[model samples]
Target chain A: MHLDKEALDAHESRWRAQLINAVAGFKPVNLIGTIDDQGRTNLAIITSVVHLGANPPLLGMVIRPSPKGVERHTLNNILDTGAFSVNAVTEDMVPQAHQTSARYSGETSEFEATGLTPRWIDGRREPFVAESPLQIGLSLLEHLPLKHNGTHFIIGNIDCIDIPDNAVADDGTVDLGALRLVTACGLDTYHSVGSGTRFAYAKPDQPPRPI
Target chain B: MHLDKEALDAHESRWRAQLINAVAGFKPVNLIGTIDDQGRTNLAIITSVVHLGANPPLLGMVIRPSPKGVERHTLNNILDTGAFSVNAVTEDMVPQAHQTSARYSGETSEFEATGLTPRWIDGRREPFVAESPLQIGLSLLEHLPLKHNGTHFIIGNIDCIDIPDNAVADDGTVDLGALRLVTACGLDTYHSVGSGTRFAYAKPDQPPRPI
Candidate 1:
């Protein structure tokens, strides 16, 4: 199948969304936890997290514009309080994490609606999902508004991280397969990955070989 | 294991890169192809592709700063030509795709060095990986320099796409499992995904159910 820009623009909105989303292949699925100034907590599943840099420990995510007359709690909360939490979505948490996308009122927390436990840390305003094996706390660093689309590209600095002790390798690589972390395609599909192969550093003179 | 910012800053650079890269879970792995004005081709393995929007078909990627005085061909080509291709990395193509990361001199194309064929479309300046099942052509739309880390955040508009006929579902979701696409973690690890479960649209009143 071949699709040009015209063909893509002609596709039904939902269908185009699914196709475009899947074209990027499997994505990192995580539940972003945030809180408003009134102490109202919000949880939303995000799959657009991209690693920006390692030295500064930066990550970027895109947040769409809020629906007409409806406030996007995650974006607003992050702007209100410069902190948020990222919790890796595991296989067991798929249903609850998917359910968090439902349109819950501002008064109702997704944690309360989906029955997921919110883990709070001392001196931190954001909440993390207790069921997640890997949790990260970040503070907003830069928020750039994309004019082409109304989406906001948000960059954050990693403040701290909590991971399972057994999941870390001697070289500092985290064993994602051991944690059963789930990846997503499109807006609704969830995939569990197999134990992967690690390759040695590539050199110009030789073919890549498994480490 | 819990790591605060201070602890993370104290770790070795390579170890920190591995740990920080893995925290986000499985990432979409793609071979980014570009060509310079003089027609020298460059291919690089990229794992930072993120879906920005569906309607305009926008995607964003991060390019790290070049080492010392070495010219990063991929970044320079995209900026010079305003065109690039994203080819989905599959299980069979992992070794060759990984080999593209080897530092080759400007005269040698990665396609030639790794024994991978480059497919060029008429009138398109970028080349797609022939071994890839899903290939996309994009034109540069915006280039924003991230001041925090000196990385470049590049946004592009999808111009065209080529996909396998049998891989697309009725609802427009592409079956990545059928394509045997692979996701990467920690810079060197590659994982094949299982057939994912698609969930029905969530409603606040009920638990999410598989579609």
Candidate 2:
């Protein structure tokens, strides 16, 4: 059956908590970002993260519709400054990282909310969460607009990466199983990455697999 | 250490992508619309799509950084029509769905790109791809400013969804394992839902695991 925009919008706006909460929970490593506000930095864990494109490297996160109807700090900071950090959360820092979501006054910093130390590098002023084994620095690519409701889709151009040395496999693919990344289910529900049985398939043009 | 915006944007603009790519692959199915000057509908599939929000139901897609930049039909369509569809890619029609990505003329419709049909209801001019097990309509959200060299971010408010009955598990979760969804790895690599072992965890206050 066919669905229209008005119908889909109503279903989405109403069942959102149930829909997103369910699907997002299946993925591994909920995304966390660090935004620089004024001079201090703010941190928030985002399960609403997705990989968009690789060439020229891009990543995206949906900031919930704020009640104020303006823009979320993360979106604004990235736009104002043109950069932000997207870090993967670990099973190790799950509790602490989640705390970044606690509601605080605009002036309050999430770093203080969770007491998670920020890692600093000599050449870069932006900080990566010391606890996260994996992280990346994303340059602001675009601030996309959702004309109907004042929502903006922010695209970041990925530049560098930091992976725990041991997690790297021989093929250059970072073995996520070894990293022990965590995935979020519905609200407040978290799960460890499940066992993965890898099976490869060939194109139809290629001969059928030897079963 | 709180990093400055200049430092953050520069680092994040280039790095961090290596990790997200390590895991999240191309698996999503999107309903892309391209209406020609004649107002005929041209729909296509986008496996590389992401959501931008819940409050406003924002959606995003990473289109190939167009060479001409002006030859964009989707961008122009949204600007003119103010809507599009973020259709979910399911296994039932993965083969036909993937075909929508094949290059087509500016005047041709992706609806015809694959054998799949675009379903439409009354009044709303935009149609949904009938085969998309789970499809949603989105109104024009926003077109973000691309910060660096090239590329843009498109955000849209979800207007509707056509979720199939079989896809939803009893618990209201999408049983991807049962659906056997496929994913895209480096470049052209496609993988199916592999091994899965789910574990449940109780609250911290609960007594330690019975030793």
Candidate 3:
């Protein structure tokens, strides 16, 4: 199949969304937990998380603009509180995580609606998903607007991380496959990954070898 | 395991990179292809591609700063030509794709070094990886600097795409697992995903149902 910009623009909105989303391949599926100043919590499944850097432990995610007259709780809460939690969506949490995307009212928390537990650490304002095997607390660093599209690119600085001890290797690599971390492709599909192969550091003169 | 920012900051750089990278979960693995003004092609393995928007078909990727006195070929090529290709990495292409990360001299194209074919479409400046099952051509749209970590966030507008027709479903979702698309975690690990479940659009009053 060949699709040009014109062909893509001509596609039905939902269809185009699915195709475009899948073209990026497997994405990190996470439930972003946030809270408004009124203490009402919000949970939204996000698949756009991208690793930005390691030194400052930065990650970036794209948040679509809220519909006219609608409030995007996740963005608004992050802006209001400067803190949020990214909880890795595992196979067991797929249904609950996917359910969070439903249009719940501002008064209704997705955590409550979907029956997912909200975990709050001491001194933290954001709530984390207790069902998640890996939880990362982050502070909002920058919110850049992409003018081409009204989407906001939110960059966060990792403040802390909670993970199972068995999941982390001595070399510091997290065994995502062993942890059964779920990944998403299109807007609605969720996948489980197999224990992957790790290659040794590539060198100009050597063949790629598994480490 | 729980790691605070202070503890993370105290870890060795490479170890920290691995841990932080893996914490984001599975990532889309692709070979980014670019060409300099002088027609020297460069291919590098990239795992940071994120879907920015669907209508405009925008994708964003992070490029780390080059070492002092070193020219980052891929970043420079994209800037010099305003064109690039993102080719999805598949299970069969993993070894060659990984080999592209080897630090080759400016004149050595990774395509040639790894024996992967560079395919050209008429009028397109960027070369696509022929071995890749999915190929996307993108024109540089924005080059934003991430001030926090000195990384460059390059946003591109999809110009064209070439993919296998059988891989696309009627609903516009691409069957990534069936296509055997490869995903990555940490720095060197590559994974194959299982055919996942696709849930129907969520509704406030309904449980998520597989489509």
Q: How do the predictions measure up, each by TM-score?
A: 0.98, 0.65, 0.98
Write down the worst ten-residue block by lDDT for model 3 chain B: B63-72
Candidate 1 off by > 4 Å: A69-71, B69-71
lDDT digits (tens) for residues A66-149 of candidate 2:
667432666666766676776777667767665565555557666666777777666554667777767677777766565565
Give the per-residue lDDT digits (tens) of candidate 2, residues B1-211: 2323443354452243343456442234345754544677766555445644455545566555456553366667767887676555554555555555444556567676566687774545576777656666667666754555355566666656566567564444454545454444333233444434332332222321211
Residue B137, candidate 3: Cα error in Å is: 0.5
Instruction: For candidate 3, list the clashing residue pairs, or say none.
Output: none
lDDT of 3 by residue, A25-115 (tens): 8999999999999999999999999898888899899898556735499999999999999999989999999999888889999999999
lDDT of each: 0.91, 0.55, 0.91
**True-structure lDDT of candidate 2:** 0.55
Question: What tens digits encode model 1's per-residue C-alpha lDDT throughout A83-158?
Answer: 9999999999999999998888899999999999999988889999999999999999999999998999999999
Residue B161's C-alpha lDDT in candidate 2? 56
Worst 10 residues of 1 chain A by lDDT: A63-72
Candidate 2 vs candidate 3, TM-score winner: 3
